[model samples]
Target: MNPEDWIAHDPDPVTAAELAALDPGERAARFARPLTFGTAGLRGPVRGGPDSMNLAVVVRATWAVSRVLTERGLGGSTVVVGRDARHGSAQFAVAAAEVFAAQGFSVISWEHPVPTPVVAFAVRRTGAAAGVQITASHNPRTDNGYKVYFDGGLQIVSPTDREIEAAITTAPPADEIRRRPVHPDDDTLVDAYVARAATVRRGRHGHPRVALTAMHGVGGELALRALQAAGFDDVHTVASQFAPDPDFPTVAFPNPEEPGAADALLRLADEIGADIAIALDPDADRCAVGIPAAGGWRMLSGDETGWLLGDYILSTLDGADAATSVVASSVVSSQLLATIAADYGARHVVTLTGFKWLARADAELTGCSLVYAYEEAIGHCVDPAAVRDKDGISAAVLACDLVAHVAAQGISITDALDRLALRHGVHTTAALSRRVADPGEAAAMMDRLRSNPPAELAGFPVTATADGDAVFLTGGDQQTTVRVVVRPSGTEPKVKCYTEVGQAVGADLDDARRRAAAIELQLLASAQTW
Candidate 1:
């Protein structure tokens, strides 16, 4: 469709004006291709064209989602809609709710901005057929997104995502889609989510001081509430970052994983003499942890946090049926969790990267439950039964519980990690990425790597190679094991390489850690060349 035709169909005058103001070349680019709905749902800049996120795009996408659900025999069922504090989120969320209501489905909408996990929890709690959240997560301020979760509160994957895209391709123009103005639902769901999140905490061990930052996102208040509800009263917050600000004025990027994103939180932790610090992404779906180091306050790598949480959660499940309980991690994550699960006699499954896949780790096993799942990108599902997706709020609560439990035992978080390293070798991990012009270039890079597998990476012979959603290379000597996984990032135009070097604990733990870190840097450097 041309720009003029798209402007005609645009429901929001703001976006229509935006389209009208675009130059001819820019207008042509906007209409050259429509946004593709993939596993992550629709995400792009907020603009007035089929290629961007706007009222028209949201309506059409919701209509397509409705059609797909109806075809799956979920017609007229309940659908939950929520949004974050990003630009255009409220309007886009309203448009989604209106479309769902017009399609004869019962729509439950939130009047206020909410974290992404609230919608996921609502879907399961209300037994809704689907849920839609308008959020870009940790993306830049200029971007927005539409995330969809099916009946089980898990994000749509594979065939469902493809089906939704196909339906969207045939959707009528935005103006032609029927819509009914709908009011937001009550706060009962949010309240219930908080209650369930609080329940994740075990018995109170100690009240360790904690410093938290929401990263100018929507998770701050709720995280505080959950923590307090779980008997964590000695909590301090980064005052400047507690409130939601769509512009993310403080951090260059909203992601806590990015460099210096948690500086404010760490600063607050130091000022308050906090025992631990936590940072949640914009949508509060990802959680990062910081602890006092020998030099200064340093954030724990995602893998380190994963190891701690996994050990803590598994430790509490003393007499449970380990045969039916499963803990999972992505292929790109460290394999120490598997060893930890083995120690507890629990099963561990490795799935492809993405919470969409990790959420359904126990789907193929009958009479089994996914007790926990995490990825190396600070996304952890500590309470899978409550919320199938990565939830920063609940993870924060659980992390606090872990801290309190360790404090009661006269051990610091660092000491707990050292204990784990002693039990299960020192596992060092790093990630390397190469940005490309577009997704095609990323695919081409992966193809080249797959076609001509490198014989050696950082002087370690590539003893084995496997191809799946990503290429996995395994090599090392008898004393150490080096593994790398390379794949195109689903949400960005970059080829990501995850590297790990594992060595058994010997007489000297510090030496093993230093050697492993050095090898990890080499592996990262070699992977960068590809």
Candidate 2:
């Protein structure tokens, strides 16, 4: 794995003209650092040489993907492709479709742009061998990615990704790819996805006063269709930032979690007196929920929404056989779910921190109905039967439905959180991420933190810590459970540091809240010095 040999298997220019035409800077960049396919699939800025996610790289990757299916006795299988409204996304989607078709696979393309999750669900619904989504998933505007889903509609994990990377890096020349024409009706997957999402809708409360924003991506239309199908005839759309634009003109970064990404929707909600505001990321697999609280449309953290949604689902099911197995990430908030599962006679399991892991793990862990699975990063899987992967459209419908169910009890979302806090004790989580300019630098930072462990962080004495190859999990499991896991972002140069603080108060919410906050401050301060 010499640095120079990373792209050794990549196709070289057969004709001097092709190499001559490549941008000098791009050629140099690719030569210096070829794209490394990781567990998260291929991701990088849409620039550089053949190593980047440009047309040449995409074609090669598609060939690699096709080769994978073929090797697994799944070649020429149906392939469903979806795309977000990101820059170059549409082109990438078409390129993928063309390549899949050229490889003799029937490609079920989307006529219009659709959410990333819809594509994953469609792969399972249509019995496709695999699916591909063209999106970066909240990354900066300059970047784009290729996310692959296997036959079961879950992302490819560990060894599978490694195998795919080998195929991609050693893929044949782009010109050698078989070219085929796409039929007029090759994009029927959109209709199927829209229809399937309709089944998850449980209707809204009262007039269904809610504001919706697509963050200038392609999810708004499909979201509206699902909302209307669910009988929410009055889902108000935010006037601005509602259209599907590749550039994402309205927001700096198309992610809804950032400040002001939900500003337009909140402003509209305030003016219309809406009960809730729903914001979906550019690709639509991830979504954020905003409730009318604290005088404005206050956005609920991923953990808060998971608790609210889990509570609603658990209480609504009437039968004793209505089993609930609450699933969450290793880094997510387990306070509410752990308590609620006990009360409902359900088992709570912690999996590695990704929707792919949660989805696949839930399927593996037997003995109970996998009620709900979510991670702190706004990914949620509501009906595992319908879609084994996270679906923003389905999550959006379920969130509104939960609001309606709670409205019947004359309670607001904030009040529900407070009651949960009273029952399960308070667990507040905070995250701090620094953008290391180089991947090596990010690795170095994690190395330094591991080699020189802090004896005392802030005020609390460091009880114990676990140093992983690429991450570290530190802090005392009692009083405050501080988890500091650092890894090079699968898709970006940034290295994320996750911290969680939990306190068990028998039933005293105030005491738990104070202790959790104090622990959080201590963890943050300690992390800052690192």
Candidate 3:
């Protein structure tokens, strides 16, 4: 179809006007290719293009989702729609609900901005056929997205996503789908989500002064409420990031894992003499933690937090039925969690590189129960039974509880990390992201690494190689060693290289860190080149 055809059917006048103003080359670039669903759903810049995130793209995606659900005998079933506090989020969410309703589906629309996991929780809780979240997660303000969840509250896997893409390719025009007003609901679901998140607390600890940052996302108010409900009363929030701000004025990037993203929270923690600090991403599905250490206050790496929380959760459930309690992490995450789980007589599973795979560990494993799942990019699924996605709120509650319990015993989270390091032998990890100009460049980078992988990284020979959409060019598999995973970011134009350098705490933790850091730095510098 031509750009003129698209402009005629486009629902948003702003988009149509923009399309009309584009030159021949610009118009061809915008409408010649359509944005397809990737691992993270339909994400792109907020603009008027078939390849960008806009009203037409969202409407088509929503229609495709409805068709996919209805094919499975969910014609009249209810579908939940939620949005975050980003540009065009509410509008995109409304457009999605309208499309679903036009397709003879019931729409349970969230009128206000909410966390991404809230929509995931609502899908399972309501027994809805599917759910849609209008968000870009930690992406910049210029971008937005549409993420779909199937009946099991899990992100759609291979065939389903492919099927939805097929349906989207031939879906009806935006003007053909009838627009409908979204009916608002009371706070029943929100209250239920808060209650369920609070139940993750074992009532083991209380009264630890916590300084938290919401990263200028919509999770602040709800996160604060969940903390109070979980028996933590002394929670102080960073005022600059305490409210929902679409522009995210306080930080260069809204993602907590980004450098200096948690600076405000750490500063507030130091001022308030807080025991710990937690940072929730823009949509509050990924969590990053910080603690006051001997040198100063520093944010913990995703692996460090993963190990701490995994150790805590596993030990708490130690006496349960043997081989029943299970934990999961992404393939790119630290191997220490699996090692710990095995030593505790519990089962551990490693999935692909996202929460979409990590969240379904329990359903895939026959007999084991999935009590925990985590990724090295600040995503953790603490209570998968309640929310089948990486939930920043519940993870923070557990982190705060652990800090309180340890603080009561005259120790800090840093001390707990030291004990974990001594036991797990210092599994350190780092990520090297090389941003590209476009998705094609990202794919080219991945292909380059696969075709011509580094024979040796940091003086360690490439021991093994696994090639696919992502490539694992590793150096050691000595039960605990080094790895480099090269892949394209699902939702952004970036080729990412994740590196992990693990070593035993031979005589001193400091020595182990020194060795690991040297190896990690070399790997990172070389990884960045590719």
Which candidate wins on lDDT?
1
> Over the stretch 46-153, how does candidate 1's per-residue lDDT look in tens digits?
888888888998999999999999999999999999999999998889889999999999999988999999999999988999999999898889999999999579
In the range 55-174, model 2's lDDT, one tens digit per residue, is 667777888888888999998789878777777787778888999998889988765777888878787887889989888878878888898888578787767777777887677656
**Inter-residue clash pairs, candidate 2:** none
**How do the predictions measure up, each by TM-score?**
0.97, 0.90, 0.97
Model 2 segments more than 4 A misplaced? 1-26, 184-188, 201-205, 318-326, 330-335, 367-369, 467-483, 504-515
**Candidate 3: worst 10 consecutive residues by lDDT?**
473-482
Clashes of 3: 0
| Residue 310 lDDT, candidate 2, scale 0-100 | 73
Position 377, candidate 2: lDDT: 73
- State the number of backbone clashes in model 2: 0
Candidate models: Cα lDDT each: 0.90, 0.73, 0.86
Q: What is the lDDT of residue 153 in candidate 3?
A: 85
Q: Write down the TM-score for model 2.
A: 0.90
